[model samples]
Target chain A: MTTTLGRPGTRPSAARLGLYRAAIELKTFFRERDAVVFTFALPAVILALLGAIFDGVYPGSDVTSAEYLAPSMIAAGIASTTFVNLGTGIATDRDDGTLRRLRGAPMPPSAYVIGKILMALVVTVGETLLLLGIAVVAFDVRLPTDPARWFTFGWVFLLGTTACALAGIAASSLAGSARSAGAVMHLPYLVLAFVSGVFFTPVGALPGPLITLGSLFPLKWMAQGFRSVFLPDSILPQEVVPSWEHGRIALVLAAWCIGGMLLCLTTFRWHGRRGR
Target chain B: MTDTPAVRVRGLRKTYGDTLAVDGVDLDVAAGEVVALLGPNGAGKTSTIEILEGHRDRDAGEVRVLGHDPARAGLDWRTGIGIVTQDGADLTELTVREAVRHFARYYPEPRDPDDAIELVGLTGKADARVRTLSGGQRRRLDVAIGVVGRPRLLFLDEPTTGFDPQARRQFWALIRRLAADEGCTILLSTHYLEEAEALADRVAVIVDGRIVAAGTPATLGGRATARTLVRWADGRQETDDPAALVASLTRRYGGVVPGLTISRPSLEDVYLDLIGDPS
Candidate 1:
């Protein structure tokens, strides 16, 4: 019964711990057929539906309907996975006691958070690629030819998804139960998306208050950022600032990332039973 | 490990709003010992266990687990301890083997995942999805994850809450194996007296946020020295000397004592008395 494993100071580095956790989280997420289907498939379905009804209706700027909505759809896809999915996933884990058990493990708390964010990023990447594939093949939207535009797409996609993922994790703590996670997360996202014109292109008849309200959320800027990468330069006038506000978009989304990370660090609840 | 106690606590107290959950409780568990915290529901057993497992904050206490304060302990300190709490472990999506291997990577010196799963009698179901397993099987998986790190200490809170009779016995054997084979100190909390008697070298009884009794099962609350019950077919007498009473009963029965029975107060009786229950 004698042994020598009681050296309490021995542990792997935090990065190694986080990598393993991320692998496990992604494995589980990929295996859940329903989660994968809803996360990627639903967005593609909505795009197809939009492409069909708005056939030949170019929002008066010679912009094909599919080309007009491609970046917005992609932005919406990233938002759903990063915000709605991760938020509810975390809240469900809390309600079911998964976070408490993981908190008790030897791994660092940040490792768990990193693992979840990584999973959201993985889902976001897969869904974006799928939507873009559909847009190129089925909707006649041209894939970016220049490597420079591809680079813009990469950073915008990364920053947008990372910021939204952080928001999801931060907001998850406010949800009281798994059942409420979806609604709690979707309230702000849906409101912003509605005003930002995600479901429909608000062409020629832009209102003032909705534009201001949309400006307050990161999604408005994220969609514009992605459009800067995917759409033609002439389409910039449809945006609030009429041109690629690339620096502002990066700054605003980066702020959300910082703010969301702070919120998650300060307020995320590993134990759901704890009182406010 | 030899000189230091596996766990030590004094004047431990915790409160929730206006209610005191654990008030002035002291306890010690030596290394390699399996000490069971025995108490009924709402008796603060879970709260005490949670605090020791470092998942809950204590209001006041001088507590050390393996010579480290759990409240301020770091990952290295946590690596020496294993826990099977009921939450944030919705590993139901993974197979038993996958979950075990996943958790194993979190530890610096983890036991082979296969060995851990087999120890809990789940080797045959290693490929089974955790959600498909029965209640007892899930508990066994919990134990596998709890011990995968070859931890210096283990905290099992109501580990066998939903286990059947056979599963409970198997779980006890597994726990005994951990203490005997691995020299792992165990702090098992449960309301089942039989489980405490079967698994623990010492039992601590907590009731209404206070420890009313703590000792070995045979001597808990003076159970071993309590008055013995001497009985015949139709006669009964409560006496300290059962041998003398048996001798007199034999003589009255003319060399044979019919229906003769001699029994001391059971641990349950002493426990009931200590908790101030009339029955």
Candidate 2:
């Protein structure tokens, strides 16, 4: 006997579904005026304010304080787009029944994940350009012309964003509601910014214990990697170590990529905590 | 198999910590039949529907939907089902058309998004942001998304809970069309007796996590054989044959039978009795 229901047809490929999901995600993200402004502008505004307040060059280097901050702020900006935005955005989806609707559909879980990460990537790229424009215009920070430097910048951006995006997906489960997601995401992000020297110059100036703690996380390494691409080598002495520590940076960020995926697999929930 | 039921459950049970949401329960919905799971709040209606929709796990049960166990069902099984949940997602940032079109992509064969909007009577508001829609319009949008996939079996969980009287009637018409024209099987859960009476080919009354009664609207809880009351201006009596009694009363009253009326136990009365709700 044969069933009359459910016609036989090939499902849309996962890649095609992922692209569709990404389109919807991007459309939703950009349409929310307040979220768009907050996510894209907050880091740039902070960089501008810090650039204006700190007027002098760092000791023994031609780099002004504003120039010193440009690269670090880019790293922080990436964190904002991937980690903070994704964490809160996912929590809001849970509170509003988005996950329930998605779960009910025939779409694959991987497609959803791909959509979110791609949305973050597109937003982060725009955000990076915005910051780059501001740094060039307001802070006299030069854009690197060397192909090798850009090559370094490319890898760091991809790996750092992936790691942070995964971590954000894992962290989203901690928020009890959409309303509380802001606090849940921001508290850790602000602390990481301070400890990772996104707010301060010269990582060596921070307390040794703080440096050690920061080194264990991806944010500190991301900032160092960005600094190596944009800032002069003469400014390297101010780092916790005299060199860029490129090998360790890669290892730490890559490890975070792996560790974050594990955490997400263990902790991610499609439904809100209150849901059955 | 052609004779296989679209949905089947045996000894289904679920618990949330200390509270039992669904006790030992059995149900079956055959292909092309529209069944309503009628129950009040906390009656395990949502839990049972969610389990069948593959959105929740049951503590213990044998369940199958569309020839596959929902607990382990794949995407193909999901493609056969449409669900209109109690509360829908707030897709506030998306326009109504965009939301419908996006969901349509999830299915292998889907109705045109514009056609779905038209079917739900939201064609006028297709381009409006979802946040701008009124409560009833949003529910209509939910229905559009639910049906866009052209599902073979549909689950509507209190689809008209917050709808006004007119909106409820309109929704009922849409549901009737789907069942009659498309031959779609439906299992809808609602606490509204009137809704169940209006839409269900079969109604199952659930109380305290168990089905207490199940039958056609007229025969549920022995309603068909139940006595009817015949009343006149001066007197009333319950009898098996209301027509005969009314004739006798008309003769005794010399033709008109002043203020004569005859009534049987209504579906509401049988339902109230089944649920043991005195009010």
Candidate 3:
């Protein structure tokens, strides 16, 4: 056989392999109906449940509960796409030896991770749009008039989901099994959502440390970005309006993305240690 | 002919923390010559294969595959080799053709997907989902993917581990055809002694992270010309010249030697000895 490097043969390209990896991920994700229910349906269900329960009850004002719940529910939907879907998916692939199989292939390792992150972003954007559609048609929620806020909503959701998915990938490597991945992946979402005022009125209404601590994570800033678009300007204290300082949110998320990328590069196990 | 060997591994050493997985091993496979790496479990076969496949690194050694050091070889060098592992991914939802075509896109001069399927005797099952195929059929599909890109050098790591007896014979024929017809250099690692005898032009016996012996199956462990053991109803004898012994016995018996038989060590016997079985 000709051992020459540049013989007349088709060699593996990173771009083509990336497309194949992305297709495999989508097919696997959709083929499992239970995964579909949790990743796609569950987030929508949570959004609708929150919208229904809170559409009419506030302390003194006549604001509908759906108006209060919309932003936070959207934030929760983003959380599901990034953390819950990604963490469990990567862990299961590792368990099943799928990741190990890809290692020998010509597929670039970074492409595989980036493909999953892109899938998570697609799911989050789809879920957010679905929640907005429900808010407009079912609860008489007003659409934001400023197009710049819409741009902010799009950028925040994309960046925030990217950050969260990176965290999920990093967290998935921490667990030894898929079951543990699910457990660990869910804990961060629950704690961060509650503290970030994702399901509540505002962190200002909560304890001072709660708001300060919430600032440490990406969820609070993401939710704040969402609320900035829909909430009336008077409702937010001047200090909390999505200000130039909010750029720090992007910086924090970028740091997490870089940090998570490093952790996954270092510790991701493609196969079982036992070689089964 | 001063070009580097197709694969030259010299004193390759690797330790997993405290355990020495591959300890000071040396090997070479000339271009276009099929060499079988034969060993039992924990004999460092997998570690050696991983290092050669460029999936794992060695602690200290000089190693080369297709003229470039695998440890530092970049994307272009990696594309020249193909590896078929023991098991493939669960591609239950995709038809055989789709899966092959998807992998084909990764390579620059990939053989036609249909041709690859035909080469593996899976043309009839091209549209079938991989999960629907039987064990032997799926194994053939795995082989198809490995050669789809027409790799210069191929690595088959326990390629037929789960094949049934009939399937194994057929797979052997396919491997021989690939070597003779396509001129593809093959490195097949297997536990089956018969497989080594049937397909490999040369077999290397690796034991405890070292290559103990390497030669044609007949000559391995000097079995080709070793003393033959002859047993009769009344007596048994061992002789280096079995033909002369049989002739003398026939002359004394005036026609036929009762219970006449001549036996030499089988490949398995030689392999066991080479591997140094305590039992």
- Per-residue alpha-carbon lDDT of model 2 for A64-130, expressed as tens digits? 8888888889999999999998998999988999988988989899888888988999999999999
- Clashing residue pairs for model 1: A97-B87, A97-B88, A98-B87, A98-B88, A98-B89, A99-B88
lDDT of 1 by residue, A100-210 (tens): 777777888878877887778788888888888888888888777899988888888888888888888888888998778767877877777778777757422358888
lDDT for residue B16 in candidate 1, whole number 0-100: 96
Give the TM-scores of the predictions, in the order they appear: 0.94, 0.96, 0.89
Candidate with best DockQ? 2
How many pairs in model 3 have backbone atoms within 3 A of each other, for residues 3 or more apart or on separate chains, i.e. clashes? Answer: 13
The residue ranges of model 3 lying beyond 4 angstroms of the native Cα positions read A1-3, A6-13, A93-95, A199-213, A234-276, B1-4, B90-92
Superposed model 2: Cα runs more than 4 Å off: A1-5
lDDT of each: 0.83, 0.90, 0.77
Give DockQ for candidates 1 onward, in order. Answer: 0.52, 0.63, 0.39
Pick by lDDT: 1 or 2, better one: 2
**Number of the predicted model whose lDDT against the real structure is largest:** 2
Write candidate 3's Cα lDDT for B185-216 as tens digits: 88889888888889888898888888888889
